[model samples]
Target: MRYALYFSPAETNPLTKAATQWLGRDAFTGETFPTPEADGLARDTIHELTADPRRYGFHATLKAPFELHPDQTEAQLVAAVERFAADTPAFDIPNVIVGQLGRFFALVPDTVYPDLQHFAARVVEEFESFRAPLSDADIARRKPETMSATHRANLDRWGYPYVMDEFRFHMTLTGQVPSEYAPAMREELDRRFSEFANAPLTIDGLALFIETERGAPFTVHRWLPLAPVSENRKIAS
Candidate 1:
């Protein structure tokens, strides 16, 4: 089993509901959904495009999946997360927009937000001790040869190429959309996520997601909300 630290809104949140419908699966409930209707896209095409994100569920990955370090226990990690959540103040990203990362798509902040970057960095650093080093197979899967020197170095050090300075926060919405499909996919995504895109997204909680085995759909193991700013300040004082 492997675990990932991710940011996901509560299951009942309207944003979550819309993303869940668009992606056709609920990471929190393990339920499958029919592909949402789109004017120019067939259900099969929509499902094909979403296959990758569907397995992972709807989330912005903070820490990529990793096995526990030999000396660490899951209970210890959970306790650490609880304590971390209790002390960190919640914040928000002012606007989110549908943006493509290479050929695939995701919801990204319209502008950089330092608090979001710092929060993500903190998660990576805070949980580093719990992450086992990447095995040769895992490293190979990341294809170090194609990575730039910095990304390769980061993969070597963090077990993920996109952490720290390399991280660009994104909640992946699809697998690679073929060049032919990109325009329509973008249009459909905009239509489907209009209520969420270009609106503030609260960074309220950390979700612990687990994969029971390779290729299995991941599911939320816990949803830990960050304490309010006032509460955190009081605790600190």
Candidate 2:
């Protein structure tokens, strides 16, 4: 199995509910929702566009997926996640909006925030001990030749091309959307996620997601809030 660290709101968060409906899957429950109603868009097309993110579920990746190192154990990783969540305080991204990343649609910060950057970088650095080296197939799958020099270096050292300076925080909503469909998708996503558009998004928790095997859907293994346990909302593990 592979594991990923992500930033996901509590299961009850409005953003989580809306995104779950749009993607048609809840990472927390292993449940599938009906494809959200999108006027003028075919349900089949909506399904096709959202297929990728649905499999992964709703999350803003903090640390990309990795297998445990030979020297590490799942128990150790869980402990580390809990400690980190307890010690690190919660923060917010000033404003977020529906934006396109290359050909895909996602919720992205209006501007790069320093605190978010530092927090994401730390997650990468802190978990270095738990990440096994990338296998040849994994490396090839990242398409290093198409990446920038900096990205290639990061892939070589960190096992993920997007980390530290290369990270662009986004919660992916759909896969590659043809240029012709961009305008409609943007409008539809804006309607679906309007409450969060140009609004602050709290960085409240660190979620550990588990992928049972290659190509399997990921599910929430744990949701640990950044606040101390006694003060935070009751959340499931």
Q: How does each model score on TM-score?
A: 0.96, 0.95
Clashing pairs in 2: none
Worst 10-residue lDDT window, candidate 1 = 228-237
Tell me the tens digit of each residue's lDDT in model 2 across 1-237: 999999998999999999999999999999998877787678899999999999998999989999999999999999999999999888789899999889999999998999899999999999999999999999999988999999999999899989999898999999999887788888899898999888999998999999999999999999999965344433531
State the local distance difference test value for candidate 2.
0.92
Model 1 CA RMSD to the hidden true structure, in angstroms: 2.3
CA lDDT for candidate 1: 0.92
